[model samples]
Target: MKHDIVIVGGGVPGLTLALALAQSTSLSVAVLEARDCVRLFKRDARVSAITQASKRIFKKLGVWSAIHAQAIQSFTRIECWDEAGNEIDFHCETLAMSALGYIVENQAIQFVLQEALQSYCTAQIFYSTKLIALHEKEDAIMLSTDTGQVFHAKLVVAADGAMSFVRERAQIILDKKDYNEEAIVATITTTAMHEQIARQCFLKTGPVALLPLSDSYRTSLVWTLPTAEAKQYMDLKPDDFCKALTCVFSKRFSEVVVVEGRQSFRLCKQQAQQCVKPRIALLGDALHTVHPLAGQGMNMGLLDAAALFEIIHTAIAHHRDFGSHAVLRRYARWRKADNFPMSVGIDWIKQLFAANTPVISLVRVSGLQILNRFPTIKNYFARYAVGERNGLPKLAQ
Candidate 1:
């Protein structure tokens, strides 16, 4: 098969980039997905806290409507409290915004991106194909799959996720860090209806965040705990698990029961040492992994895809070399500037919130009070959450 661009992952970032780039007259694209097709409504225990920037990108890619119904409008505010669940509040109104951001399910977003890609006649979609080798010639990149099929393209995108084969084959190094913790995520039914407010409770163990779901009464939990404890929680029966959770999380939202299945993911900080490698480029989890505390991992990946598309599209429009070092370097520069800070910020949050030091607790609590006291910083965050901040591609902006 022949294409201008070949994306190795059929996940959200790969599919969205294919759709976004297909809009440009200069490129023809294809997405190679290794996973079997997933059906809608299958419980995706993972939920994402999407920023305003992510929403705008969806609108531009023409999938916002498909995702809107399933998305929970999170206009109220997000509150973080100490272990006691008291002595604090942070309101969205402080920034003069109706909602800070929105909560969306992982499955729905994947479905929407898949459906959106289907609308692009210029893009080819492939499933169950895994890249096995990449041979970069003078003018094009060749990709071989495990099935022995080969593909040639002007550029190969490495959206193949955290352990990207493309990045590995190209010999790209990653700056990686691990918190020695695991995040246990599950969907649950809450006795108390969530009033559109997101909650993150910082405990000595780790941070537990409750995200709103489509239904008023349901919410999702991402609880980061020590690796051993997370495994223990995963092995517990539902009744015992809920009881143990309530002991730490409390009865603030009664009737808490874990969904049908639960999963634990190791928490880590990893960023690609290089974002662009000759004919190959990296995006999304392939490039960086932030702590899930802020839920910005996917958002950062999508932003990378958007920025790359802009750079490639501009070069193609001017009839310049789109795959040259000059063209690819621009994308690397843009992504590093934004992804670097997010990686650091998330690490800071992990260290800041997980400590049991009395002084650290005092500082974190007082920090919240001060944060709420200043409308300027609050508004800055509010704008950034909504995608008004900066570094977005033209289409995303």
Candidate 2:
């Protein structure tokens, strides 16, 4: 098959990019997915915190309505506190916004994206197809799949994730960092209603976030801790796990009980040394992976898709080669400027709270209190949190 663009992965970023391009231009697009289409719709235990800006992008792509129809929980109040008693709260009403953001199941987003691509976008989707080789020609890129299928495209997109085969074949080096911790996720029922508020508490070990769900008493848990501790939690019986979690979050909720499966993933930081090279560009986790403490991982990837689309559309309008290094580099530079600082900031926050020194702890507490004291500052942070503050792509606006 031949296409103007070939995306190496069919996850959110790749699918969003294809949808955005198809909706905005006449670019021929193809997505290579390693998993079966049916398996892609299976219920994903993980959920993502979608920012308002990302919601706008989805709306622009004509998929937000479908995603909204699925199970989603809007959080209007965000409360964060440290073990030292320093705390801050952000309410949507205070900012005159509908909600801070939303919590949607990962599978819900994928399902909707898949549906939108089929109904609204003309992009060809090849499932159960894995990239086996990538060859960059003088004017085009060629790809071979595990099934012996061959594809050619003017440009290649590496949305294959952190361990991107496309990126590896392209020989892009990643500046990686391991946190030596794991994030444990599960669904739990709380005696108290979440009240449409997202709560994050910084513990001595790590951060635990209880995100509101469609069910008022059913919340999603993302608990970050040392690798060994996370393993222990994952191995614990349901009742024992509830007891351990109750001890961790005893300050906020009561009678927490595990209601579903538990899973854990090792935490890490990865930023590709280059997001673009020759006729190829990286998107999503293929470009960067940040700590999940702030729930910005997927949001950032969505923004990348939006930004890349913005550049490519402009290039096409000018009759320029969208695969040219100049066009691809523009996308890389734009994302790095915004993504780099945010990654560093999240990393700093993770480290600051994890510090055990009394002085550092006092400083961290003081910082939170100061931010809480000033509504303007808190609102500024909120804007960024919803991905509407900084340089936003046209679609995001």
Candidate 3:
């Protein structure tokens, strides 16, 4: 089989890219996914905080409307505080925006993207198929699947995951840091309504985020803790876990009840030394992974898809080889510049907050208070968080 572009994952980023290419250009795109379609649709329980930039990209792809019609929670304000009583608030009104971002379940986004992809005749999804080998050619790339099938493409995308087989085969080095921390994710119902506000509280161990969901009384929880402590929390019965969560959260929500099963994942900050090699470009988790402190992981990946699409579109307009190293390097450079700082910054923030020493705690408290006093700085951060920035792709703009 032959295709203009072969994307080696069926996740949100990969599907988004395929749909964008099929909608905007004549490229024949194929997506190779290792899981069944049903499994892919129901895999992720976590919700993603979609930034304004990502929403715009989805709009351009004609899927945002469907996603909006589905269950999505929009939060206009984000309130963050520490155990020391220092608090910082970010409001969308201050920035003249309707909402900072929308919280959508990961599966919902995937379902919408997959459904949209079906309308494009140029895009094909191959589930239960995995890439087993890749070979770079002068004019094309050859890929072999676990099913003993062979395919060729002018370009291949490594959107598999953080542990990407394509990236490994390409010999891309990764700089990784294990924070030795784990994040506990669950859905909880609180006695108090969320009021369309996202709340996060920093504890001595780590930060806890209460993301507003569609239900006023339900919120998604992402609590970071040491690995061992996370295990203890995960092992607790539902009622006991809710009690502990209420206490740790300082009873701000009155009372909390775990409404869904809890899940935990290790927290790590990792970035590929390079995001491209010849005809192969990395996207999403294949390129970088950051701490979930700010919920920017999916946002970053979506922007990556947008940026790569723009670069390829421009290359096609100019009659340049979209898969050429020169063209792919533009994407690599663009995303690295944007992703590197975020990865480092989130890691720094995690480390800074994890330290509960007297001096560090005082510094944290003072920093939040001082930053809160300056609307200019806060607005700048809020803008960045909502994906308002210079050099954005045409789709996102």
Candidate 4:
């Protein structure tokens, strides 16, 4: 197979990349996936509490209808508290046009994205086609698949994920380490219905969040705890887990005596030594994978796709090839600016709450109090989560 571009990876970022890039060059683009097909892609139940900025990108891609149909709208409220159940912060009433953020199940999102990508454009999806080896030349890169077929493309975009095959073969270095915490994620039915409020309680060991879902009677829980503690909790029966949850959540969640679809994953922080190199580039988790504390993992990837799409066009208009070093550098520059801050922010939050010292606790809890009091400050941060800059890229705004 031959294409102007070969995108490796078919997850959220890769599909979004296909949609974003199709708008740029008239080049033939092919997305290669290892999956045999896009069936009920049972992805992680973890949902993205996405910002409005990210929603705008979907709107531009004509993906909003699918998401809206499948997603729950979160407006009006977000609450945070300390380990002692002291309210740290709250967001409400007015913070731009909507509330703080939205939460969408990852699997449901993948299903919708697959549908939109298929219907929105003419790009072909190559399922179950895994990249086995790569050889690059001045004009093109040759990709050999597991099935013996070979592919040729002028540039390869890797959104393959944290353990990216292309990124490794290309020899891009990364800095990574585990956060030493495991997050137990699940959906639970609450005794008192959620009135559209998102709440988080940060413990000395970690943080537990209850994000609003579609049914006012149910909520999503993401509990980050010490790895050992997480393992013990996961080993508990459903009933026991629900009882334990009540102890942790208390009255805020009302009754929480039931939960479904329980799952757990270890937390990690990984960043690339560099985001781009010559004809190859990384996007999404391939570039940087942060902790799930903020639920912005996919949003950051969407931003990367948006920026790269625009940069490719600008490069083309200037008569520069899309794979040129300068062109790739432009993508890197835009991504690095945001990626670094986000990595730091997520890590800082992890460290802040992970501490047990009383003084640290006072500072952290008091800070949340101050943040809760200021809607102006909250709105500004909220805008960042949604990818809304006053000067957001056309695809994102």
lDDT of 4 by residue, 149-206 (tens): 9999888999899999999999889888988889999989888878888888877778
The estimated TM-scores of all candidates read: 0.94, 0.97, 0.97, 0.94
Worst 10 residues of 1 by lDDT: 83-92
Q: Write the per-residue lDDT of candidate 3 for residues 255-370, one digit (tens) a residue.
A: 89655858999988888888898899999999989999899999899889888999999999999999999999999889978887777778878877888788887787777877
- Give RMSD to native, each candidate: 1.9, 1.3, 1.5, 2.0
List lDDT for all candidates, in order: 0.80, 0.89, 0.88, 0.80
Query: In model 3, where is the ten-residue run with the lowest total lDDT?
Result: 36-45
Superposed model 1: Cα runs more than 4 Å off:
39-41, 71-75, 84-88, 255-258
The Cα error of candidate 2 at residue 186, in Å, is 0.6
lDDT tens readout by residue for model 1, 1-397: 8998899898888888888887766478888888876656465788788777788888887788888876655747777776655444446676566667788887888887777667678897888887778898878899898889999988889998888888899889988887789999887776777888787888888888888888787788898898998998999998888887777556455667655458899988888888887778899999888889888888888899899888888888888777777789999999888877777877876777777688977777777677677867766765665567666787668
Mark the 10 consecutive residues where model 2 has the least summed lDDT: 36-45
lDDT of 2: 0.89
Q: What value does the lDDT take at residue 303 in candidate 2?
A: 90
Q: What TM-score quantifies how close candidate 2 is to the native fold?
A: 0.97
Most TM-score-accurate candidate: 2
Candidate 2 vs 3: which has more TM-score: 2
